[model samples]
Structure formats: C-alpha cells, structure tokens
Target: MTDHLILRPSGEFAGPVDEHTLVLGIETSCDETAAALVLGGYDVASSVVSTQVDIHAQYGGVVPEIASRAHLDMLNPIIARAIVEAGVPDSRIDAIACTIGPGLIGALLVGVSAAKSLALAWDVPFIGVHHHEAHLYAAFLEDPTLEFPLVVLLVSGGHTMLIEMQDHGRYKLLGRTIDDAAGEAFDKVARFLGLGYPGGPAIDREAVHGNPEAIHFPRAMMHEGLDVSFSGLKTSVMNHVRKHPDVSSEDVAASFQAAVVDVLVTKARRAAQQVGAKGLVLAGGVAANSLLREQFLDACVVDGIHGFLPSREMCTDNAAMIAAAGWHRLRSDGPTSLDCGAFPNLKIPGLT
Candidate 1:
C-alpha cells in the first residue's frame, strides 16, 4: 500500500482511479477514534480505529465527557499509525478529511481541530465530512463504480434512516425513526434483559440459539408509509419482560431482533421500490448486526436490486469511510473553509 500522487492537469487526470492521491481521514464521531489514508475515493491504503467499548461498557453507554477526553488522547496516535502503515509522510498527503457533524460536540472537535491543524501544516485542502453521509459512502469504498439511485439504510447507535442517493452529495430523505433509533433501542432492550452493554452485538449473539418465533413482538408502524417507529416495540419488550419474570432472555432477544430487522428491511425495500432504485446499501454501526444484514441482503435479492455492504469494520464508524467521502467532496467542491467548526447536529446535505 503506497501513497503517491501524480501531479497532473485535470484534463490529464482521467483514467483508472485505483492509483489516486492520498487523503488523510479522521473520525471521532462517538466512542470510536479513527484515522486512515485512502487512495482516490475507494482504495483504502490504511485504516485505523480505536473503539471505546470497554470504557463505556461499564457505564452501559457512552458518556459524553469521557468520550471527548478519550478522543483527545487517541486521535493523534491513530492518525500517526495510519500514516505510517500507509507508507506515506504527512507532507505527501494531498488532503485532510474529518467528520465534522452530527456527533458528540467535544468528540467531533478533537478530529476537526486536528484536521485544520494538519491542513495548515501540510498546506493541503481541508474537507469536512458529514457523519451519516460518510456511512452511506462506505459502500463506495467497497465498490466505487456502483450504480446511483440506490437507497441507503444507515442504522447507527444514535440514528436510523433511509436515504436515496441520486448522486454524490445529493440525497432525498425518504423516512426516519420517530423515536429511539434501532441501535438505541437495542441498547435499552439489552440492558433491561441483562444482556449487557452495546445491545446490538449482545442481542445478536444471544438470539442465535433462541427461537425468533417464540415471542410475538410488535412490529410498529408496518403499514404507515416509509417512516418507522421502534419506541413502541421497545416498550413492548420492557412490558413483556416485567410481566414475565421467567421469560427466556434468548427468546426475548431473538423476537426483539426480529421485529427491528423486519421493520428495517421492509421499509428500506419499499423505499427503494418507490424511488426505482437500482441497489440497496446497508450501512452504519447497526448494519453490523447479523440478522439485519442477512435479511436486508435477502430482501434486496428478492426484490431484484443489488445489495452493497461494507465489511463489518467499515460498517461501523471509521475514518476510511470519512476519507473516502472526503476525497469525493474535495474533488467535487474543493476545500471547505478552515473556519468551519464542529456541528453536533449538522444535517445531511440536501435534506430538510
């Protein structure tokens, strides 16, 4: 994995894209501190991610203050490792990219500030990447030449939504969760079930040996258009557990996982068909869930649409996706102003 850029005119830059310039990416969106060097938009030279699971696991979930301070310590070293692993000096990096929005404010700043400092030092363009937008772009890293007009299902710890990508940086928000995000619900349900921290993985593992049909979990808002709601289902899980003291944790987990997966795949597929999409891309942290991934891909095949999924590592938050998205943004819109600051609630571009 070599990081080399050909200094050529724009007219002369057209050709195979596997040998593209190197972009440094930083991500501190939540509990993960990550950095990477990506070639072009799709070729990943090196990606480094530091997960804060052990620190937050004792607390049930991520604590904002702890998350930020951790990022401050982890960000720089991770960046250095990625640069070293990619076999490139900081001076040779062509651009810098960082997740700048829709994440913990303090955590987001750790990455954005580092990017600005690096850009100034290296004299490279600074690109700010939207967190959710980058999740969608993870699919491109797996295969950059994928057909457009694909619907992306981004299901993370804090967010879950269906977006139609008409093209790069252009999107149509089809639907979103009305209350708790899928991953959030997973955490809550898992905690109540004594399944432990980071619910998605916990529930996924337990549900494997359990019977999904053992319990009749409610699938909320199934016929109510594309928008989804998991709050009701979560409540139902709590109520059931409270009422049935002897309830099997595995059964509850399997049933709960089934409900969430059913809603997600159904809504995503319907949204794709509504927009005449050519493919369906499952992304974000929750995309790493076993059931959701299996059902999503099966649904896409049944519907006759291609399915695109990043590796489990890429499915979760990582700088490689941010770097990949940043590379495209740098090429399409030039550099973002260095004065731009972190936006914890920054909306995805082209959405109301």
Candidate 2:
C-alpha cells in the first residue's frame, strides 16, 4: 500500500466544503482499479491506480473474473490513498463519480459499487461516467485551452471510433471500426509475431528500427469515407506469418503498425475534412503508441488540422482522466443517487 496520510482539523475545517467541491473519482473499467481526488475547477489533488497487468500478462489479456476480483481487493485502499493524499476528510468530498460503462460488467460493478457506497455513506452525490467519453475529456486535464467543436479519434483495445464534438455534451458519431478495434489488432498481431502482452507500445518500439515499407500491407477502407476495418488486415498478417514462418519479428511489427497507421490517419484526415473540424484529438490507450502519434501529427500537418494527445501516462487507464470527465458531469447536473447501476455496453451518451 502507498502511504498518503495527512493530518486535519478536529472540529471545524478552515473553509466551506461546498465552496470548494472535491470529487472522488473511481475507474475500474478494465484491468485497472483507479481513484482520484479532484478539487472544484481543474485541480487534481490526488490520483491512485492499482494495476492487474502482471496477473493478466500471462493470460495475454485481461480476464474478467480476475480483473473484478483484483478490483475488489484494491478499491478500498485506492480510495483511502486518494483521500489521504488530497488531505481531505471524507466529509470534504462533495461528490463521487465512477466509470459506469463500456467495459466488463464485473469490472464496472467494482468501481460503481465503491462509488455508490461512498456516496451513500457520506451522503454525497454520485455521478456515472462513460469510459470512452472520459477519454475524450482527458484532453481537458492536460490542455485547459482545448475547446469544443473538435474531432476525436477514440482508439482502444475494444473500441475504435471517430466522434465530432460540437460542445461538452453533444457528439456526432462519424465512423467506427467495422471489425476488430485498432488496439485489439495490435495485440493480436503482436502475439502472432511472438511479441508479449499489451502490444501497442512494444510494437511501436520495434517499428522504430524496422522499415515500415518492408512488406506491402493493405490499408483497409481507405476509400470508404471515414469508417475503418482491421479484421481483414489482421487476417492478412496471420496469413503472411503462416506463409513465411521465419520472417523477422521487427519487420512484422513495422508492417502491422504501418497498415494500422495508414488506415487510422486516412480516416482521421477524412473526418477532419468532412466535419470541418479545427482540431483533431486522439484519445484511448492505443494513442500512447509513438508511431501513431507521429503519423497522426504528420497527417494533421498536411491537412492543416491541429492534433492533440494526452501525456503518455494518461493514455492508459487512470483516474485523473475520469475525474476530469466527472467535472463536466458535476458542473451540469450536480450529482446522482446511489441506485445508479453499472452499464457494460454503454457508448458515448449522444453517439449511441
């Protein structure tokens, strides 16, 4: 356990708790159990994330049961750590927010249950957040100057979508993956090439030395407006590896990334043009890939569209992003009741 204890006043605290709302945000959407305390406005007081990567690493991916069990074990400690680090007593927390959907049902329940419990115990408001929407709002935490009417490319292990954001609450679904998500393709291809788990970063690292043009790979749906597909591409990679069993892994990684990047950038460029968006923001765990970042920036430069990405550490699962997302929810509606249940297949509120 990480120590973050802080002393506080005994009777009356210095300032009004309502004047400065501190929100406790919890996220257990997948394999990470995260908690963060964010002050009213934009300050992140404390963030704690307990990962189940090692436990899931051997399985090549997250096991829903294992993830839920791990979250059950870490949820309380993670929340306690956030509160301690924030130097705020439980009474100071104005609201509780949690990732409520678009993830494993069991995993989502852990965070939702914890948030509901805290809200009930403290008589505070409870707010539910969508995981992918939270990813888009992550930009707010890193870049306060970021405004709306932008295009968001949300790429993750389970999702690949293009969203046009008109404002804080309004969204237009431009396109989405027709098959496997980009991150899922990366993981599957990496496994095929004998690379280990959590494949995006590993593939990106290997692609640096290998030539992306080494093998000719198909860029799917390049002419099909903004919709994308990676299943055909993943199958192509599998077939290539089977035909050439002795091919170099580095070359395979490069070729795979090249194909993915080509499709992603192509679609993003089209989305920017179609929607006339001024900015292009990349969100989700796969956005951490250095190659994707580089390729998207290059595409944005050619298209004269600004590209934005969160810090690499924020790309994966974390509560800081969730807290930032919760800020929007709290600002709009205040809080929620304890009966808010976790939703497994939730999409972006408006996009669905």
Which model scores highest in TM-score?
1
Measured by lDDT, the strongest candidate is 1
Misplaced by over 4 Å in model 1 are 1-19
**10 residues in a row with least lDDT, candidate 2:** 1-10
Report, for every candidate in turn, its global Cα lDDT versus the true structure: 0.87, 0.82
Model 2 per-residue lDDT at 221: 77
The TM-score obtained by model 2 is: 0.92
Rate residue 6 of model 1 by lDDT.
12
TM-scores for every predicted model: 0.94, 0.92
| Candidate 2: tens digits of C-alpha lDDT, residues 1-352 | 1111101112222233342777788999999999998776367899888889889989999999999999999999999998999897788787777998879999999899878888788877677887887888877777777666799999999999999988886799999999899999989988877788888877988788888888888888788888899999989988988999888778888988988988898888889888889789999999998888888998888887778877886788888778777767666545554556777877566563
